[model samples]
Target: MIRKCRFAAMLAFSAMMSTAALVQAQAADLLSTLNSTHVLTIGTSNDAPLAYIDPQTKAAVGALPDLLRAALPLMGVKADVRAVAMPFSSLIPALQAGRIDMIGDGIYATAKRRQVIDFTSNTFYNPEALDVAKGNPDNLHQLSDLCGHSAGTYEGTTYVDQLKQASAACPAGKPIDIHLYPTIQNVFADLTAGRLNAGVVDSSLSAYALKQNPALSFELVADYKPADKAGSACAFGVTKGNDAFLAGFSKAYATMLADGTAAKIFTKWGLTPTSFFLSL
Candidate 1:
């Protein structure tokens, strides 16, 4: 009887050990599959109210981060939002090389980028504008006004393409002299220094710059209509085949929209929130 009891106890111990191992294995597999702790890297510029690096904290704090924070929880993922500083022109290449997972700030979805990256549903739409030195000196009001005048823009941006298009259509000898800068700051600096008569950029960014330099006296030209089809919108860029991550992001985004979290963030940034299709 003693031998049998001892054997039964040993068998029970073995079963418990096997059960515990299985449970641990299952837990490990779940952890591996969920990607809960992976860093959700984002790229952005110093564009204020959108994705600027806070001077005090040296961290990204703006509309995009606020929105992402609200959406991340629904995915059962905790994101370590690291801002990878890069020129706006380099953003796409950085994304393709996996230097960053997504762009945190404003990005207009263009046909060229659609081939390599997938964009999340549009978050906010804003118009593009031209910034010129304060006063009516240039009398530059529209793209046509730029004929025979110098214009500066950030390289590799939609604004550059728009300027180029306008230039191409101009009558001979009436083409706008286009200057490409590596960064928006440089473009604006050149404008302030009178190196360029006007700088074309996103409206929100131009507003922020005006706020930063109240005495700068830069005015938005009145004649330049915002791009007709160029309603700039912010979207997340994911790898083309990243279905798991994409699905998770879409789910979280939907929850945020349904709960009005997305609207609140946009409102905080003084942006008009627009309805978006939630199909992942």
Candidate 2:
């Protein structure tokens, strides 16, 4: 009985020690380690103008990726940023699990999200917009206009909540038909096929889609709610409690904003410097 008891205690102690070591390993400064290794693994998504796999080059190209490439060098580290494409909803969890070092896919830094992840200061402001088929069949100009019509939005995006708000306050008490998609591309696809009357997405994405494929037969209604442009200001996301990485990233990101590197990238992706550098 005594030997069995000793063995059980030893096992428990070893397990606790292993857990502590794992916690310590995860608590190391990510920025310093990346600086030493000259590599960064970023979790991203297929959101155009933010982060997506470029069709031509089959490489990740967008405002967020470009900004990271430019800003990391400012942190005394010349990093080769490798963006791994995943669903938008998976980015945060992956960061927390230490599967990815950072997220550069234009994750909005909302108060609720701040509890689970750390973000650099506001990098860009994306106003909500309605994307409709060519000729504006439904004439859906804004969020309110979606009432009594089908609306498409991606899961885990601010746009989903925006649509729901519009639905609840619909003047005629007609709830908007909400359709959830796994990705922005899925929403756009359904909208294009007339499966959905409109899709609520970032204005920048609407513009990029139209610019990239003029024959897509889609039109953007920018400033959907001109009077109240209630939208998220997005930034890069890191693990929630990784203060070391957050501080270093924030400093380097601020430098990028000051040096016009961020603006240049956003402009290349069809966003104005004023919109992208909201709180620069």
List per-prediction Cα lDDT, in the order shown.
Answer: 0.74, 0.78
- Write down the lDDT that model 2 would get: 0.78
Q: In candidate 1, which residue pairs get closer than 3 Å at backbone N, Cα or C atoms, i.e. clash?
A: 134-217, 141-223, 141-224, 142-224
Could you tell me how far off, in angstroms, the CA of residue 50 lies in candidate 1 after the best superposition?
1.3
Report the lDDT tens digits of candidate 1 across residue range 165-224. 889988898899999988788987888888998998877677767766777757777666
List candidate 1 stretches off by more than 4 Å.
1-34, 229-231, 270-280
**Of the candidates shown, which would achieve the greatest lDDT relative to the real structure?**
2
TM-score of each: 0.79, 0.87
Which consecutive 10 residues in model 1 have the weakest lDDT in total? 271-280
